[model samples]
Target: MPNDHHNAPQTGLSYYGLSLLSYLRESHPDLADDADFIRTRAQAAAEAYSCIIRSGGSRIEAAEEADTVLYRGLHFSLYGTLANVIRSEFADIIPEEDAREAALILLPQAREVARSYELADDFAATPQYALLYTELTGTVQILLDNGIQ
Candidate 1:
């Protein structure tokens, strides 16, 4: 929520949909793989967050409509695969489950973010793509430090 730098969704209240939703604002019917990733991650994150909430934890979906979408995409414009993006960027912040959660939160948005820019020598070398790739790393660190769990 609001990226308080202290209150990330640890078990149930993450703004997963909002993060991915921003990257997918555009349409590209030809890119089936990227589209699938975006769709799948968004749906899974939604369900996971919902499950956490239903079990009695508080939910913070309200932030989903605000800053989480528009302001964050400037960071992850890289071209690497989703796993590499997370591995490189979120090296220390994410644990096993957190990594899983982040993937669920990021896969789709990552695809769109990647597509927003063109790539070369593989998705990892493109400048614009690399920028966004590194941005996600920073975001993950922020989230982890704040307590995303």
Candidate 2:
């Protein structure tokens, strides 16, 4: 049989990354609108992938556990960063109530986007890995430029 995956381009993100970005931008414009928020969340997604691959070992249980732990860790990290940014940037400008409401509106959507990324295997040594990282961050940048996020 031919190597179906071999034809995959080495210098671009996998379809999964692109699709997730589109989903986040189209489904949750609020998260997409905040560049910092988007970047932080994208970093979380990338970190999750790294953790999954690093700690997965040869066991399925390990991979699953790593996924769970890293997902939660990165999620919390994103929230922590978000809080600090809001305090420094939005506290005096935007009313607390409005900021809270905006967060509520965007949090679930951001979580959904963050949760969509998963890794089945490690590709870190390959150009695809570079592409994945580039794509995730680039997606946010693209959205930012478009004023979508």
Candidate 3:
């Protein structure tokens, strides 16, 4: 073995984090702008991803592990944060209850998308993953734009 690991393309936490941030920026700028919150969660995800990769896990495995860490309690933490942001940012237009409801609804879908991405090949480069990301982001954008149904 000629230190082949070094030749491996970067395909773990960094890629996942950037992809996540990009999607959030596009679909949920409020969430994306929460640097302290996002960075804290991303750090935890990166740790999980790094641990899995260090243990000789495949990229998919590492991503799955990272997602698990990242989304642990998404309904509570992520949803609550989003709800707060929506409530405060759009207080005049969107009702607090609607913001809460939207956050709750979006979280499960977000988790599903994360799971789908973990199962896809080539990380974010695969068409399947790209499609999932696009669909989820679109859904988020729509919910934010129109409020919960």
**TM-score per candidate, chains pooled:** 0.32, 0.28, 0.36
lDDT of 3 by residue, 1-149 (tens): 57433223223436555655665544444365555555667788888889999999998998888887765543233344445555665667668767765665567766655564454223445556546545555656676677554
Model 3: lDDT to the true structure: 0.58
Where does candidate 3 clash, by residue pair?
A: none
lDDT of each: 0.47, 0.42, 0.58
Sorted on lDDT, highest at the top, how do the candidates line up? Answer: 3, 1, 2
Please state the error at residue 42 of candidate 3 in Å. 2.1
By TM-score, how accurate is candidate 1?
Answer: 0.32
Candidate 1's residue-wise lDDT over 1-149, tens digit each? Answer: 36432222222323554454444332221122343454555566666556656666655653342333323333332322445646656666555445444665655655555565654434444566557666666655565577764
The residue ranges of model 2 lying beyond 4 angstroms of the native Cα positions read 1-20, 57-149
Q: Over 4 Å off in model 3, which ranges?
A: 1-14, 26-28, 73-149
User: With candidate 3 superimposed using the best TM-score fit, by how many Å does residue 133's alpha carbon deviate from the native?
Assistant: 23
